[model samples]
Target: MDQAALRTLIGQLADDLGWLEQHARTQPLHVAQAAELHYAGALVRNVVGPFLEGHAALPLHVAVVGGAGAGKSTIANMLCGAVLAESNPQAGFTRHPVAYAPASGAVNWPSSLGFLGTMQRLSKPEPSSLDADVYQVRRVSEEAGQFGVLDKFLVWDCPDMTTWAATGYVPRLLEVTALADVIVFVASDERYNDEVPTQFLRLLLRSGKMVVVSLMKMREADAPAFVAHFQREVLDKMPARAVATLTVPHLTPAQVVDPCRNAPVYRVPIVNQIFVLGEPVQAARQRTVRSATSYLMSHQQHLLGVARDDLLALEGWRQRVREGQMEFDNRYRREFLTTERFRRFDEALVRLLELLELPGVGRFASLTMDVLRWPYTWTKKLFASAFARPEASSMPERQVLENGLAGWIDHLRKEAASQTGKHPLWEHVQHGFSAGLGNTIKDRFNESFRGFQLSLGDEVERTARKIYEDLEKNPLALNAIRGGKFTAEVTTILVSGGAILYSGGLALPFVAASLAMAPLSASVIQMLTEFFGSQYVDFHREQTRARQQALVAQHISTPMADWLTSWPTTGGSAYERLQSILGRFPHNLQQMEAAVQAAMM
Candidate 1:
């Protein structure tokens, strides 16, 4: 537990807590968790770290805290044995904590670095009503009879907790509270059962600070009953700690002005209680440290819950990304895969058969066959030329791909729009979707699709070339297959012509043309059917389909998926920042926690 090392660790913890506080949005748990983190950091840096470094414990802090107009300043004035703070009649008058130490400055206070967490130290005197993130230290005159009994202690007069303005300066209060070893809780007759101050008391008690409840602005006669009621309603339910409850009778301004001198009899009891709690400074500091650590340990689940909420939000974003990917893939399959004809496949088949022609001898054999069938070939060509229809116009592949991608982008945008208010992630995605995100997606998709299209021709040609290359290795089998294909063509053409002539009618021209070219068309169809049935061709076709599917996925599906998956991390997105901060804060806290525990031991 090197003091410097401990200070460095605590410093980092303070920074992490500050980050949490800044990002705490609207959730109550998130806000409370951030406050708790700040409190923990303050304790480590201001109390534990300084104590370990052998800093003086004599100047033990005693903070008087309560709701607005709860007689907090009166208690501070009484503790100092004089009117050191302004006890105004206005509610929420005290907006910042004012520290009252001995004029002699006998005890050295902890530096501002970790003293009040993020609150700045005001060098010039400022009114307690100055509502800001700051604290000011002022030394009170050291009259022999005033503050003489509590020479080694520093008393802090803190702002009211129940005021709306308190939100702006409550961190200042928590900061002073974290520095305190003892707390003098002031509650007027009206505020005794108030929810806000009671909860604050509970937090203090839970943190293990020594507390003395001064029930103020109550008649002396009703003190007993009030004390009993306060004990039953507040004290009884709180965990056992070193706590004392007393009654401060309502007083006039004159009496409050010089509480110790004018009402010496009334002030003696409160002074005695303070004396009892502040002596043996080492023991008091240890109690504070142990109490803080215990509170942190007990509330570990709460802190973790805060982190879990953040991660759950992140998970929601990831789930949306996956859904978007699925939608994209579905659209591509429906718009592209289902409608695509792959007409190039037919051309590829013919080219593959041409490659299988025998190098020299097979050509001569084929030529002799052509000469014998010259009359049939000539008749088939004449009729085919007369009846051939023009190829039908269709959508270009590029247009189809672009249309499908646009549809997918539009679908995602609509989904985001519909789900905008459902969750934080959705809201973030919705905002981004409207901000040119669709254009970015389109650009990436088009780039990938272009590359895919360029390689498609080569892919089909390669598959056909492979079939021919395999056939060339087995010339005898190739020639036999070719001879059988030729005979099948001639036989089919003759049968088709006989059928057309026997069933003659006014439709003779069209039917006759179709039958005449039946030798070439029917033979090619039969040859392909037989070749596709063979084990080798079947394997090749399967391979080609698989490769084609892979190409589609790589170019289109993969790009869309990648964009959707990574959208949350893109620059300027709220989710990206949330993810980064959430990850870093919790991990740093965990490590700091371990270091703190070891150092304490």
Candidate 2:
């Protein structure tokens, strides 16, 4: 792969990992996953990128790592054959890694582009307690050509792994460790079996770095037994094929002299182990690359768990959206659809009868029917005027729809507010809804409702007109049928009025009056059936009702429901970002993994 393209891919992966780290929930497991993801990205940008660029691996990096007060600085000093690092007595003393380059100048330090990702190299030395995201480099001075023993090597003394302050500088440690071709795991007798450093050592071995264990501050007589136990407890579970273990007896102050001249004498076995491993720099670097690649391939699922955490949060949001939709649907059914009578349907029926009149004699037929039905129409009108009951007003469709939307938003807001601390998704939703989301939904619903209302009248008229157009094909039969409807209308009014009088006003008067008119209406509808030779009138009415119901859904219910369902995934929303991160990060990681495989091949 092209170096520039690789860098771009690695850079993007790092950015995505950074975003995940920042936005993932604050749970301990989630934080640990984020940290792991961040470390993986750093490895790509720093270790893998430089390797692919064909940068010289002559200056092999060896990082000394261990838990707090595990004698890591002393081990680093021993490796360099000099007092390159300050081995203080305080636990967790080193906050950042300090690199010591050999004075021989046989190999140049890595360029700023890919060495320690994101950590600026300090020009002047700062205190080990200066907790910051930076690293310091110091050149080891030659004493009688003594430092030349480990020429062409860069040794890093890393901060403690098991400390409260370690969290602040652990990323610095991971950075240098990822760059190392060899890892000198310095474990004291007290810290050897400790979980924190042991896990770190496992990770280093799993990543394919050559490791040399230095069991420090143990009695000379007990060294053999201690080393045996360390091997069985720690090394047995490691993935590395071979790991060199050296037992460092409790040394006097004089024995901790300059490692350049005294390393071969005092730490002869450890010094010889380093020389044997450091001789094959090219092979060692290749082994590191191969090990890192294998670790990544095998651990891809672990990396994807980070993405899954965000996806799980998104799924929770979707579940809430589904619940909110159910609420909206239920509210709409109860508050609006069930109570709506569609009074305009009556007007459509009357218009249908007028259209049934003979095409050329429409006006004459209408007038004739009017004269015949005048008595019944007049009597019914008088009774209706006298006994009409006022309807109890209820909320309009617009208000009902708006309220349903508001209620749904309120539900989500309350849920989010209640659970904000539990997950990042809820907190994000709470903030979004608080910032005009409800108003936005209402505005969208109003727009759709107005459009629905505007088209409703035309839809009803068209349906009614279709019924007449079908009937017009048999105008002669339809006209005669229409004439008989007058007689039916008169008979219906008389019989229905007598029945109402017999019933003694038991029903609401308006309802009784409507009931009285039903037979006439049924008679006219029967003529329509006769003319059309089918259930045309009933079907048309059913079709019109269905259309109106659909309009209610399309114009009002659907928009609001969709808005609620999709609110979390809207543009610029946290859920949207999480989805993007989940999708892009994994794809990029797989691509980088494949690239690593190709580079190793």
Candidate 3:
């Protein structure tokens, strides 16, 4: 596939998994998987797709991500080398991100399709509103270009990931996280060791992102020990492509308000590190894309674990269907097809032998045929005649079919009841039986059985007619029969004092030999005719039984089996869609992974 098709697929798969995670009914959500799914979608939608679409990687992103009240906004302002970020005392006050582009050389920050996912871009500043899924872009100037790193950067003052409000905007947080070429992780002394922030840091590092950690609001004396502890606790235990840490002492109120002049400690090194991390903007962006997608590719199974569970449930249903089909077929063969006697074959044989008579002597030939059939006709006539009457017999085909269908349902019901709570399929089947799956199938079977009888009768008539016509239309067979009659006449002629070699004997020795061979030839012709007619009858009998089986399979068994097999997917239910979602996710995810990885290469 070309790049456009690849992009479409990647976008579609990202949407699919994201939708499944959000909507599909399934087992309990794995909290880590849920979060990772969002992050993974953010990676594909904001980073990989845009990169593959030839979006330029310039004015690289740096997100300020930390916990609530961790001085994220203050840190963002200081990083701007001036007060561009909103500094609010309310914890998690920054509900949406505010992008601070460098006034010096900030163009091509990010188009809506580039890095912003489902978020709407605001033309003007409105970071305090908690209602919209939006982010704003603002340009902040450096006095005399003191912190020139801002020239090639778009710093995002993002929302806190620790507050209750964080849940609502976590997707927005992830979008920034994936878009950034660098992460400026600022942990206030109180929030540094917290589990939520620490776990978030681990995720960022494991993606091979370049992270610069700033220990915010600490004493000059405590900075050394805290930095060492933060490294041991976070950096050492974490994974990363690059990590650099610095300490920021408690700033004066004047310094906290003014970014460039009074907050030199916070402003200088933070800028220097981000600048160094994002120096070659192209390389930095590529590294971020590779790391994020690699993380997505590696953790897909874990991310799609809930979907996998749904798939397993569907597979379990399929297995039960197969087992039920086997039971149904086995019962049919055992109870009906194995012992069923076809009376049509005997009728067809009677008709076939009647064809051996010469024209205008069918009456005499049929009588002769009746007498000959007495000696070598089917020995199973007793059994076949019993079925032919339909009054004195074993279980009929209809009863066998009804019983087989009932047994099939019973087996499925028992199986479903066995694992009642294990999956939705069982529950569905359990309820389906209660709602009359059996009766529905029986009603359909009644309709099909009527059709089956009509079709089978027609087929048998055709078979018998074909048998009768074959020998009648054959000249060789007709001539043989005529010669048999002629031989019989000749034998009588010689016995009555006449020549008998087909009624002509020139000498007495010839007449004697003809007399002996006459009876043998007549007997041989009658035996051969009976022999071949019997074989044809038996062949047709087997075919008729097979045809019966096929009718049962097609008109009865197959339709029922198909309906039962597809029961789970028929209803417009969440689990039905869940099957579809699970089916599409794995292969599409693998393709998306391969496509992005190949594009990266």
For each candidate, give its TM-score against the true structure.
0.71, 0.75, 0.72
lDDT of 2 by residue, 143-208 (tens): 632533357567888988899777778888888888887788889888788887877777777677
- Tell me the number of clashing residue pairs for each predicted model: 0, 3, 0
Candidate number achieving the greatest lDDT relative to the actual structure: 3
What local lDDT score does residue 390 receive in model 3, on the 0 to 100 scale? 40
**Shift of residue 563 alpha carbon in model 1, Å:** 3.8
Task: Pick the TM-score winner.
Answer: 2
Which should have the higher TM-score, number 2 or number 3?
2
Q: Give per-residue CA lDDT, model 1, range 261-344, as digits (tens).
A: 777667888888888877677677767766666665576555445556556665665565567556655655565555554555
Question: How would the candidate models be sorted by lDDT, starting from the highest?
Answer: 3, 2, 1
Model 1 residue pairs with clashes:
none
What's model 2's lDDT at 517? 73
As a TM-score, model 3 comes out at 0.72
Off by over 4 Å in 1: 1-16, 25-58, 81-83, 112-114, 117-127, 130-133, 140-149, 206-210, 236-242, 249-283, 286-317, 338-400, 420-434, 450-562
Candidate 2's C-alpha runs over 4 A off are 1-3, 24-29, 88-90, 106-115, 124-132, 141-149, 237-242, 252-254, 258-280, 293-301, 304-313, 341-395, 451-457, 471-576
* Clashes, model 2: 3
lDDT of 3 by residue, 548-581 (tens): 7787778777877777777777788667676676
Segments in model 3 whose C-alpha atoms lie over 4 Å from true places: 1-7, 24-27, 104-115, 127-131, 217-242, 249-267, 345-403, 406-547, 554-556, 570-601
